[model samples]
Target chain A: MAVREGLLALLHEGPRHGYQLKTEFEAATGGVWPLNVGQVYTTLDRLERDGLVGVSDNEGQKVYSITVDGVSALGAWWEAAPVDEPPPRDELMLKVLMAIERSTERGDAHAMSVITHQRTVLHSMLQSKRRARSVATTSLAARLVTDALVVRAEADLRWLDLCEAQLNGTPTRKARS
Target chain B: MNDPVLELVDVVKTFGKGSTEVRALNGVDLAVSPAEFVAVMGPSGCGKSTLLHLAGGLEDVSSGRVRVAGRDIGDLDLASRAALRRTDVGYVFQRLNLLPSLTALENVALPLKLEGVGRREASARSLDALAAVGVTEQLSRYPDDFSGGQQQRIAIARAIVVERALILADEPSGALDTMTGDSVIELLSSLPGRFGTAIVLVTHEPRFASWADRVVFMRDGVVVDQTASTVPVSAAGAAT
Candidate 1:
């Protein structure tokens, strides 16, 4: 879905060849998602076949451009909020929730251990991201991506704390020694 | 079991006497264990600052007990309390209070140096603390030569440089932009694990509060509610 929509959006700017679209997509997303050249051309072919794009002659090379329908489609894509019809099936969430359910059935603390272990991992990830953010001087995009990761890691840690608090009821407040 | 790094039991603080008295805190009870981070959130005039002052031994409680590193603060004499604060507790404020003439390394080393630590040892430890807060390259830069974020890092370095068991921060990120503030909070969150120090952070921002292990809400000089954030781990990843 990203490649198809990304190709449409890139073509919206101007006519770009297939390889250019791939490079531009990679750059826009900070290279987090690498695009296959074959996949890009296949998507372009489908778009052209569906009247969403058109192949035009540019000095002797074939360039892809958005059609009227493609412009309308891109506009629609921009206007609509991304759909989560299937409710994103994240592997980590599935694993945690499943672990919680299983631990509850078994009357064990395995779920709590999972949450704690995950918290430690996320904390280290956050530290590395912070280190990266401090040293990253060349690319604003890279810095922004690292910042996002740090925020996410912090949130994940908060959630793990929440999971422990819920599983154990109120957190015990120990008296001073 | 190990002792809590910070504790307050039925703590009360009054600013004046009789009719003119203002009750800044009333019978507040709290504890922070080593490696724990607790955030206190409230509106203005809600005794959050008073709680921090008591924990850090900045001000004496009118009644009730305040303990740090398992020692009762009220029982300690002035010199002893000052020594406790210098050697066992760390405090960070909205205003960094870094000396303009000192470089980041020197500013961080000042606390240990004041405690009679040798210059070489203090400088080495200060550099380690700065690196922990991700401020290595700016060690030689003075406060005026750095940005708000860098200055705050220096302040944090100074706070933890003495290997203090407890850290009391009062809106330490209050002066920075949202992004920079989040970075500061992230840095603070990492400290408890890295240094095995307990942290009591006072802030009005919920976003900042969410980073703590527990969020305590104070109102009218008393704790009203406490809640652990229920944000799902995957949801956090998806939020960005």
Candidate 2:
């Protein structure tokens, strides 16, 4: 989806061939997402089929440019909010819940230990991401990527803290190791 | 590498005796080299605050050495420790960072004045400290007139005013909102480079700790781990 919108964003500037689109997209993203030339052409085909792009001949090679409809579509995409995939990739939370259930039966403190260990790991990850951001001064895209990771890790750490707080109710908390 | 401005070697601190004894810190070792920023992070009752207290000489260590500017604090008497704290160490707390009645310049100059410097010279040095923290406007304005973030900056200015070898701040960002707290932490992260003073910050928030050159984690009165950030700082050394 982003590739389609990204191609439109590039074509919004002017006409470009498939390889040009691929290189420009890679450079624009600071090479964080290297797009194959084939992928670029495939996305362009879908965009052209959807009337978001118009292809023409520029000295034998095909050139793709944004159409009147493409500009409007890109504008809407820019303004629209990003969506998170619901109920997806929540493996950590599931593991914690299952661990709590078993730890309750076994009378062990393993669940809290899991939370503590994850907190340290996430904090360490954040330190690395923050370090990356500090040194990525030359590339805005690289810096932004680290910024995203830092915040996401911070959010996970907050959730772990919340789990710790909700624990310690005697029945569930002091399940001795 | 520069000599550590502050070093805690196998330090221990306990409150009360025998039956009711509370071991606040049990065998923690840390070193803060010149112009380095170290953050101590842990949950409550983890001895983070106790460690800062010992580092600033506000409290004595029980069984180990705390050396500030190369002198072991355990060997110093009360008067000598007071003088050392006055001259070599600075402290910043979460609240009451500045006196309400004193103007910004006076707040910054308070430490120098207590050190027996002349009023004119103290004021001159205080002005530079204020400027270093980017507090140039309204030197005559009291702390209440400034915003919370500005107030924190002034408090930091006071801490750094006297070229103290080290500054120990305990939860300095604990009271502010997220954005304001972030700005304050940013200011602290810049201090080592601009002032040549080592900083040991005690905070539970990982966000703030991420800015430090190194972070020491405490658990149940023990130093569980110390990790160094990849951010470049002077005298980068291995964490123990």
Candidate 3:
């Protein structure tokens, strides 16, 4: 969804070749997600077919521009809110639930160990993020990326703590030294 | 490993008599080395605070030994234990840390003052501590005039003023908002590297506790488990 809208957003600025959009996307995302030039052209073809973009020959090369419809689409994307309410089904939730279920079935304490292990990982991640925060000195995008990782890591640890509290009925496994 | 600045050997703390007794800490053993960061976490009534108090020699241990900077606090006299607490220990509570009557400089300098250091030398040392925590302005202002986050920073400056071997902080960021709380934890995580002092932070929030090098979890007056940050779990098994 973002890739499609991101292309339209880039065109909304002005006309650009496929390579320009590729580089711009990389720069904006801090090079976190790499985009293929072929895929960009394929998506551009679809946009042209849908009347969302116009192609032109500029300096013996093809350039893409956002049409009126594309502008409206980009505007709509801005107004549309993302869904985050119901706590989307994610891998961590699945792992924890299964670990607890397995522990109960086998009369063993597996979940707390899982929780502790996950917490330790999150803590180490946080430490690295702390270092990154200090080093990500100049660019706002890079700084925000690090901040996002930090908060996400923090949230995951809190969820693990919640799981530990809910499973307190089970005896805590004596942690390994 | 460097020698532990604080060590609790088979520490047990209890309150009241037989029928009305409540065992706060049950045979907990922990050692925090110099320049290490340790956090204690648990449910309510889990003796996290008691563990912290015993570490700082704020409360007497019912049995076993408590050592600070390699000296046995239990073996020392009352006056001597108090002196140890003053000279070798620093505390940061959730709130009410600073004296309302004193300026920020005086509050940080109070620890050195209590050691009978001269006014000139104490003020100079206090300024350095304040600078270390990134506080240079408003030294003349009282604690009441500053925001909660600023007050917490100043409180931290006081804790490190004398370069104490151990700092016991009990939910230092409990009262601040998310961003402010995060900055406080960030400042604390920098302590071990900046000052070479050991830190024992007692907090229920894993977000704040995640900054520590090791985290200890307690239950029913017992140290149930602990996790160290050295070996992070595979990033492939991430979170929600």
TM agreement with the true structure for every prediction? 0.63, 0.82, 0.88
lDDT of 2 by residue, A1-177 (tens): 478888899999999999999988987887778988788888999999999999999889999999999999999999999754643326768877887787788878788777766666667777776667665655777666666667777777677767766766555565442
TM-score of chain A in every predicted structure: 0.82, 0.86, 0.85
Query: Residue by residue across A64-148, what tens digits does model 3's lDDT show?
Result: 9999999998899889996345434257788889999898877676887777776666676776676667656656776777777
Alpha-carbon runs more than 4 Å astray in model 3: A83-89, A169-177, B229-240
Candidate 2 scores a chain A TM-score of 0.86
* lDDT of candidate 1 over A78-151, digit per residue (tens): 88998644423245567678878887777676776676556545544544455566656746666677666666
Candidate 3 C-alpha error for residue A105, in Å = 3.8
| Model 1, position A86: C-alpha lDDT score | 40
Least accurate stretch of 10 residues (summed lDDT) in model 1 chain B?
B231-240
The per-residue C-alpha lDDT of model 3 at residue B222 equals: 83
Against the unseen true structure, what C-alpha lDDT does each candidate score?
Answer: 0.78, 0.83, 0.83
Per-residue C-alpha lDDT of model 1 across residues B181-222, encoded as one tens digit per residue: 888988998887788887889986655665676667676688
Q: Which segments of model 1 are wrong by more than 4 Å?
A: A1-66, A72-177, B229-240
As for model 1, its CA RMSD to the true structure in angstroms is: 10.7
